[model samples]
Target: MALNIKQTAVAGTMESSDVMVTVKPAEGQGLVIHLQSNVLTTFGDQIRATVQEVFSDFGIRDAEVFLVDKGAIDCVIRARVQAAICRASGEGFNWKGEDK
Candidate 1:
């Protein structure tokens, strides 16, 4: 299994990045993360690492993550990833441009 994400950059405010993850129907445990980062010091790297951390719990080894980053802090990165993961898992949160 491999963890891969087909990411795309959207043309708009990069203040807060968004992820649109879709897991393959056949897969059992997978991680799909779409992450973005603003022009900050190691922010992108931090977001990626944080996302991976979240997936680590599920032992996710397959996924396609997309990221659209806005100017956000590390905490925001973690929160967004968690939110997406929650939504993906049917935990039922909200991703309609709302707060985490």
Candidate 2:
């Protein structure tokens, strides 16, 4: 289920309690996450873990992710990351399947 990312994509917004996620193809670069969040000191690990989980779920092994968080919860982060990844990969999600 490895995704062949064709272009960069973004999802979500910068509103309060929302997060903006950008996914880009990085052919040989493995997964690289650049995150900026106000709660970095308190929830950085959790946020990164969420993003990593999404990447793993999509079987994405090479890509660069940029995330700007505005206090978004776990679900929001997961959705945004998933959306961005789908857009970048030009793939449709299987909402009722194992992707969740």
Candidate 3:
């Protein structure tokens, strides 16, 4: 079972996500991603797919992401994750990809 995720409201055209995941103390640390979004405009699948793709680029596994959206595009989500990952790892958002 998983914990219920809540929304974190903010003003902007951003598609943000709150990710929480754990690494095993031992071996075989698998990946886990929990995504929740209020971006109810037939764009949930696209957003989810984009997030997964971005995560792969950063070599991040075993992370849960909860997203609450309000009319946001896939680009926004990708941007948010890029920013969050940069902040998380104390690096930069080296995002080099075509606009979705």
1-100 in candidate 2: lDDT tens per residue? Answer: 7787789999999999999999999998999999999999999999999999989988888999999999999999999998898999899977787544
Model 1: lDDT of residue 67: 59
In model 3, which runs have C-alpha deviations exceeding 4 angstroms? 1-29, 95-100
Error of 3 at 68 (Å): 1.2
- Candidate 2 yields a Cα-based lDDT of 0.92
How do the predictions measure up, each by TM-score? 0.52, 0.95, 0.57
Q: Which stretches in model 1 have alpha-carbon errors above 4 Å?
A: 1-36, 92-100
| Candidate closest to the true structure, highest lDDT | 2
Error at 19, model 2, angstroms: 0.4
For 1-100, candidate 1 gives per-residue lDDT tens digits of 2223223212233443433333322254455555544553566667677767755644456555565666655666556555555544544434563443
**The candidate that achieves the highest TM-score relative to the unseen native structure:** 2
CA lDDT scores, all candidates in order? 0.50, 0.92, 0.50
lDDT of 3 by residue, 48-95 (tens): 688678767776664555555655566666666655555545454444
Q: In candidate 2, which residue ranges exceed 4 Å CA deviation? A: 98-100
